[model samples]
Target: MSEAADQHANAHTFIGAIDQGTTSSRFLIFNSLGEVVVTHQLEFKQIYPQSGWHEHDPNDLVNSVTTCIDGAIEAFERQGHSAKDIKAVGITNQRETTLVWDVRTGEPLYNAIVWTDMRSAELVRNLKKRLGASEINQLCGLPLSTYPSGAKLLWLLENVPKVKEAYEQGNLAFGTVDTWLVYKLNGGARANVFVTDPSNASRTLFMNISSLTYDEQLLDFLRIDRKKIHLPEIVQSSHATAYGSLAVSKLRGTPITGCLGDQSAALVGQKGFTPGLAKNTYGTGCFLLYNCGPKPVISKHGLLTTVAFDFGPGKRMYALEGSIAVAGSSVKFLVDNLGFIKSSSAISALAETVEDNGGVCFVTAFSGLFAPYWVDDARGTIFGITAYTQRGHIARATLEATCFQTKAILDAMEKDSGHKLTELRVDGGMCNSDLTMQIQSDLIGIPVNRPAMRETTALGAAIAAGLAVGVWDSFDDVKNVNTEGSTIFKPLVHEKESAVQFARWEKAVQMSKGWLA
Candidate 1:
C-alpha cells in the first residue's frame, strides 16, 4: 500500500509479522516501506532438567503471542496507524521443534520438544544403526540426528505416556512450531490446517526432498501411522492461508500469508535470492544459510541440504545450511552462567581489554557442536586456561568461539556450493556489536554487511505477506522498500594472523571434542 493511499483510506494496510522463535515471541508491524512502526517481544521460558532434555509450556508460547500482539497493536495506533489496518500476518518460527496436542481439546499431550533437546540422541543413534545415516541423509537432506523432529516425535511416542495414548487413540495432532503457533493463533481447538511447509518438513528426516512430501518408508521407520496421528497438511511457504483469527484477542479473519523457518526467513530478509548469496543470523544460536538455487546439493562435509524455502507449490528454492549450537548464548553464559561480565555489552569492552585470546579458547558447546563438527558427545570446554589468563582473555576467547564456528560453516558452504563467499549479510542481536562484526569479517575475509533494520526476521515475514496479498509487486519493489540502509565492515585482521587463529581453533576443537563423556 502506498503512503498516500494508506492516508486517504485506512482501506489498505500494514503487514503483521508473528516471529515465534526458540527463546522468544515477537510481533512486528511494518508498512510498505519495511520500516517497523511498532514491535513487542517477550522471552518465553526454556526448561532443562535432564542433561539433554529441553521443553517449553505450550500455554506459554500461546500467551506470549496474545500479549506481544496486543502490545504491538497499541504501539501501532500510538504511531498513528490502526491495528485494524493490518491486512495480513506472516509467521516465521523455529523449525523442527515438535508438539503434539489433542485434536478435540487442543490441550498439549506433552511439553513441546525443543530443537535443541538431545534426549532423543540415543533414539537417533539406534535409528542410524538401523537406517544408516548416509541413506537417510540423502533421502531427507538431513542427517539421522536428534536435531530433526522425526526422531524427537518417535521418542515422544515411545516415552511420553500421554502422547502415546493420544496417538494410539487417533486424537493427537502433530506439528512443528510454526504449525502449532498458527493453529493456536488462528483458532485453537477447531483449527484444522494440519500441515507443514517443505522447508520445515525437510528438517524432519521424514520428508523426501524431491517429492516434498512425507515418505511412507520413512514413516514406517519412525513407527508413525497415519491412523494414529493427524499430521498437518503440507503447504507452500508463501501461501495466504495456514492461519486466520486468534481466539484470545477476539481477532478473526486475518489471513496469514507467509511462513518460513526462522533461518530461511533471515536469508530472505537479507535479500539472498541469487545463487552464492549467503547470510548468517547471530541469535541465541548462529545459523548460516547459503542459497544454492533450485537443485538440492546434498552436503558432503557434514552439512545439511535443507529446503531454503518453498516459494509456492510451483516455485522452490534450496540451500545448504550449517548450524552452530551456541553463539550469542555464549555471551549470556559468561554473564549469567559464569558471572564473568555484568552484561552483554561488557563483553566487547572486556575483550578489548586484552590484546588477544592470550592462549585461551572457550568452546561454547553447552550442548554440542553442530554442523560440520557434529560431536554429539561434546560439551562446553574452556581450553588453554592457564594461570596467566584473565577475565578479559576469557571474554575474547568466548567471542572468538562464535567467529571461528561461523568461519567453519562458511568453509562448508564454499565446499557445498562451489562458490567462495564474497560477502556476508548479517542480522540479529549479536550482529549489532561492531567488535564481533569486525572479527566476523576478519575471520571470513569477506565484507560483513549489516542492514539498518536488525528486525529483518519480522520484516522478512511481513514482506512475504505483502507480496502474497498484492500489496507489493516484485523483488525490485520489495528491495526498494525493505533494504533501505546498509553498512559494511571490511576485513582488518592480517591474513597470516587469521590463519594462525584458525589453526589454534582447530587444536582447541580437537581438545574440546567428546568432553561430555
Candidate 2:
C-alpha cells in the first residue's frame, strides 16, 4: 500500500500510535505509508459505586499503556519488524473526562472524573436554570446539562478538600485523559509534556468556541483561581515537538506526534476529511460526530461543538458531536454485571436468537441519557417486558440500545448542520456485531460501512502524526497505504417497523424522565 509516498516508505521510519480509550489502552505500530503493522491491547477497571458515579484508577491507565507498549514491541519482533524503526508516536484518548493530579509528586490527586459520571447532575440543572438554555446552547454549542466537565470540576472543588487545598496552594494540575497519559508516559510531573490540544480542550467547558481557547468569562462563572491551578497549554493536536521518548521500549526516541479525543480520531482514521463526512464509533459508548468544516455550528438540539483536530499551521476544523453514554456498556452490564451472558461475543448470538425485542426495550439510563436528551435523573428502564421474554429478547433490546441512541444523535446532528447525512461510517468494538450493524442500518434506513481493520481510533492518531511529520502529505497520499475493510449493512426491515420501534423507545424515554426530582 502507498498510504504515503514511497519516498518516506523506506524501512528506516515507522509510527507508533497509543490509543487510550474509556475501557482499555492499546499500542499500535504503523508503517510509513499508513498501515497497522502490530497492535496490543489491555482492558482496565471501571468502578461504579453509587448510582450515576463512575471512576478509574489513574495508575491503571499508566500500567495499561506501558504494558501495551511492551507487548506491542514483542509482537512486532515476532513479525520480523524492528521496533526501532519507529520515528514518532500519536496518541488518541477519551475526552471531556477530567483528571486532577499533584504537579510535584505526579500522583493523581483523585480518581478520574469519568465523562459518564453524573455526580454533577444537580449542579448542571441549577446552572441551566440560572443561565438560560438558549444562551448556554448558542454559546458553547452544547446544552446546559450534566454531561459537561465544568460542573464536574466544580463539584470536586466544593466537595474534595484535598483537591481544593492542592488548588489553593498552586500545586494542582487538571486535564483530560490525553494530558494524563502524556504526563505519565513521559515520566509524569518530572519529565513530561503537560499540554493538550484544541480538539480535546474544546470539550472542557472552559474553552471559547470562537477563540478555540479558554475564556475568561467562563472561568469567572466557574470561580476558578488561575493562580492556584495549572491548565495545560493548548496546542495543535498534530504536533508537540514530540513528547520526549518512551523508556523501557524498543521504539525509543519515537516522537509523540498526534493527540485527538477518540471520536475525532475515528473521524480522521475513517478519512472523513470533507464536510458531510461522518463516523459513528460503537465502543463502550456510541458517539456520532459530523464534520462541519472550519466553522463551528452551535446546536439548537443537544449537541456539542468540538474541534475535529487542527492539522498543522491551518485553522482547527470543527465538528458537532452527539454522544450516547451507553452502547456497548449495556453489553458489559449484561455479561459482567447481570451474569446473563458468559462472554461478550455471545451477545451477538443471543441477540440473533430472537427475531425481535419481543416487546422489550432497555433504556440503559443506568447512569443517565446523553445527546438529544440530557436527562441525568433517568435510570435504566426496560419496558414492555412480557412473561415470554427471555435472555434472547433482552439481548436483542440491548443491541437495539445502540441503534436507537444513534438514531437520536443523527437527528440532532442533522438539525445542527441543516444537512442530512447520506450514510454512516461505523467503527469500534461493537460494530463487529453484524446483528447490531443491521439494526443500525435499518433504524437509519441507510447503509452502514465498517472498515476492515476496525482499529480506526488508533489509525486516526497515526494519520494525524504522519501528516504533521511529512510521513504523508495531503490526505490523498494516505490512500495508497490505507487498507480498508468492508462490511456494509443495508436496511432490511420496512419503514413502519422502524417507526414502530422508535415510538416504543420514545415512551420508555418519557417514563424515565424527571428522575432527579
Candidate 3:
C-alpha cells in the first residue's frame, strides 16, 4: 500500500518461532500481542533402526525447519507483510535428542539419537553401579535415565567410529537439537553459533542445576573429555546475540534471540511464570512441567528436576517434570496401524461410539513407561479385552491410557512440590479431543484449560524472541494474550469411578512390566 503503511508495519514487526518437536517441525509468525499471524508445519520421519532404538537423520531435522520457515514466510508475504517485517526468531526443540558433528566440516557423525531411544539403558544401568552415581541428581537435577542426552552421548562415543575418532581428534562438537539448529541456521561452521539454553542443557545431565553451568564431575563420571568434545556454550533462554542471526531463510539475517526446550516453551507460552503453575503438553509424547520457582527441587518421587527457562541473566527458573513416552502417538497408532480411524481427530468420534472402555485398559507403552514407574521393560499391552469388545472400546481405552498416565504423574508432582495443581494448562495436537480433555480433567480431578490459540509451543518461542528484541516491554505486556477465548473442562465423573478406572489402568501397567526383561 502506502510507503508510510509499509514503514509502520516494519516498525511493528512480527517475531518468528521455529518449533522443532518430536514428530513434526513448524514455523509460526506472531504479532506483538502473542497471536499467531501465519504458520506452516512439516512432519518428518521417525526412524526406528532396531528394536528400542529411535533415531532421526540430522539433515532431515535441519531441512524440515528451514522448509517450514520459508513456507511460513511465504504465507506472511501473501498476507501483504514484507519479509523484513519479521524482527527476530525464537527456537524451541524436542529436548535430549543428542547430536554430535565435526567442528570444521559441520557434518554430523551419526544420526541424532532421539529422546525416546532406549538403547542406552544398559549403559545407564552400568553407570549406576559406579560410585557416586546417586549424587548425579544433586549436580544435574536428573537421575540416570535413557531420556537424557548424556547416556546417548556415551553410547555414540563408544559405538560409533566416526564420533569416537572426532572425539579423540578434538573435532567433536556436541549439542542437543536446538544447538544443532542454531549452528546450521547461522551457516554452520561459518557463524558457529553453538549455544544452548538452560532448559535444553539441563536435560543433558551435564549442567549444574544451581550455577547453570557444566560440571566437570559429571563429565568425568561419563568419561567424556571436556577438551576433546566441544559442548555448546550455555546461554540465556532469551538472549540477544548468543543464538546468532539466521543465515538461511526468507528473512535471512534475522536475529534468533530465544531458545527453550519444547516443554519449557509451552510453560512460557501458557503464562506459567508463577510458582505452582503447571502445564501438560500433548505432543508425540506428553510432558507435565510444574513451575517450582527459582531453586531446583530434586524429586524424592519419580519426577525429574529441570530448568523451566532462563529469560535473562539471573532470571532462571526450575521445574519438576514428569514425562510420558506416548500420548498423541497412541492416536497415530490407531490411525496408521490399526486403521480404526481415518485421521488423528477421528479418534474422538470413534471413542464416542463407546460409553466407556468396557472393562478394557490399554497401557500404551509403545516406548515403555516413564516417570515414577521407570518400567523400560514394559511393552504396549491391552488388558481385560473380551469377545464383546469393539473398535470403539479399543479407541476409548487408548485415550484412557494417556489420561491414566497423566493422573499418575500429577500425583507424583503434587507429592514432590508439596502443593496440588488446581488446573492444568494444555496445548498440542491431542488436546483438541474433547473426549481426551474431559477424561484428563476427570482422571486428575482438576480443570483442564485450553487456549483459543493452542499452538503455544510456537507461541512460547515467539514470546522469547519478542522479549529479547523488545517487541513487548515485559512479560506483563503479553500477559493478557490468549486469555479471552479459553475453555475449561472440569471433572464430570465421580471420584469413585475415577479411582476405579485408574486402579484398573494401574493393574494393566503392572501386568505389562518386565516384558523386555
Candidate 4:
C-alpha cells in the first residue's frame, strides 16, 4: 500500500466495545470521531429457576458476546473497513453476577448467578447477623445485601454440589461476568486471561475501595478462602497489559485493553471525569453513579461505595452508586408480561394517554429495593388503585416508578456526598423517552442531560480501549468528541407537586416492604 493509502487506513482504524449487559450482549465499533460505524446485539435467556432466583447459562452469555462481535465486524468490513483496522476491544459488563468454573476443563460448574438474583437473601441476612454490617461496609464499601457478588458466591458454594466439590478439591475459579468473558474470550484454559478491573472487583465485597485490591479480612468474613477459590487478579480499568488478547471472532488476536462494570462504563462514557458529576443509566435496571474522586467515601446513607474506574496505577476514582432493581425492565414487564403495550417503545405513548398516575403509585421492586433502602423483602407493589383506574394510569405509574426511584437515589446521594447534584447525565434504552426524561428531571428537581449518542455504555468501553491503544492521545482529545449536541430536560413541575408525588412514592415503598417475608 502507498503512504497515502496507509494513512487513510490508519484514519479509519476503529475500537470495539463489548457491552455484556444483564439481558443482552452488544458489540459496537467506533471511529476516531467517537461515532459508531456499526453494531450488533443479541438477547439471551434469563433463567428463573425459582422465585427471586435468577441464573444465566454461562455458555449463553459467551455465545451472545462472540456472535455480536463477529456480526458487528462483518458489518464493519462491508462498510469497506478492514477487520484488522480494529485496534483493541474493551469490556463493560453487568456487575456482581457470579460465575464459577473448572481450572482444568474451562466449564462452568453452575449457571451464572445474575446480579438481580435474590436467592442469596437468606445468606446475606445471616452474614449481617453474624458479622454485622458496619465492619464489612467499612472494609469493602458495601453493605451485606443480595446485590453483592460475595453473597451470590456464598450461596453457590453452599448449595451447588459441583461448585462445592470444586471448592473442596481446590479447582474452582470465581469471577464476575467481566472476568468470565475475558477468560473465555482469551481461549479459556489455553491462554486464560483471568483478570478483573477495579470497577468489577469492587462489587464483590472483597475489594477494599481505597486500596483497590481484595481485602483478606473481608474475604475471611465471607468464609471465602483465597487459596482454595481462585480469584482473578485485580488490574487497572485501562491498562496496556491487563485484559489480554481476544482469541476468537473476526477480530482475533486483538488486545483487550480496558474493562469496567456496566454502570461505571456508562459514567465514564458520559465523561463524568470530575468529582460530584453524576450520571444515571436507565438500562434493564437504573444505576446512579456519582464520581467521588480518588478517595472512597463510605456512605452514611444506603448507597454503595465502589471504584468508578482505574485508568492506570494512580488514576483510580471512587464513586457512590445507587442501584435500582427495576427500571426499563418494568417497561418490559408491561409489554411482554402484561400486554399493556405492543412494544417497549410504545410505553411512552401509552403512558401519555393518562395525564397522571391517577392516584396510583407503583413500587417496582421486582427483585428487591436497592440503594438507600436495602430492603430485600420488598416485592413489586401498586397502591392507590380504585375502580376507576385505567390501563393508561397503570402505564403512567409504571414509568413514574423509575423516576421516583431515581429521585430517592438522588436524595440519598446528596446526603452521602454533602452536595445537591446540579444535573444528571443519562443514557441507555429508556432515555429515549422524552416523557421519562422529563419526569426524571421534574422529580429530581434538576436538569437531565441526554447525549446525542445513546450508546454511551458501548462508547465508554471504546473510549477506554482507545485510550489504552493510543487512538486518542489524552482525555482532552476525546472529552468533547461526541458531546457537541445534547438534549437537556428541565424541570416543569413545581417543587411542592414533586415533593407530594415523592411522599406518595415513599408510602408505596413502605407498603411494599416485607411482602416476601
Which run of 10 residues does model 4 get worst, by summed lDDT?
A: 3-12
TM-scores of all models?
A: 0.95, 0.95, 0.97, 0.97
In candidate 4, clashing pairs total 0
RMSD of each: 2.2, 2.3, 2.6, 2.3
List runs of model 2 lying over 4 Å from the truth: 1-13, 131-134, 240-242, 247-250, 480-483
Give the per-residue lDDT digits (tens) of candidate 1, residues 353-409.
Answer: 988889998888877889889888878888887889999999988888999999998
lDDT of 3 at 271: 89
Candidate 2, residue 282: the lDDT equals: 92
Off by over 4 Å in 3: 1-12
lDDT of 4 by residue, 1-517 (tens): 9978855664587899999998999999988777889999999999998988899999999999999999998888788878888889999999999999998889999999999999988888788888445598888888889998888889888888999999989999999999999999999988878999999999999898788778888888887888898999998889877888988888888999899999999988998877989999999999999999889999998999999988875567899999899999999999889988899999999889888999988899989899889998999988989998999999999989988988888998998889999989999889999999999999988899999988888888888888898997777877876787899999999999999999989988898999774
Clash pairs (backbone) in predicted model 1: 194-232, 194-233, 195-232, 195-233
Quote the lDDT for 121 in model 2. Answer: 76
TM-score, ranked from best to worst: 4, 3, 1, 2
10 residues in a row with least lDDT, candidate 3: 4-13
User: Sorted on lDDT, highest at the top, how do the candidates line up?
Assistant: 3, 4, 1, 2
Residue 153, model 3: Cα distance from true site in angstroms: 0.8
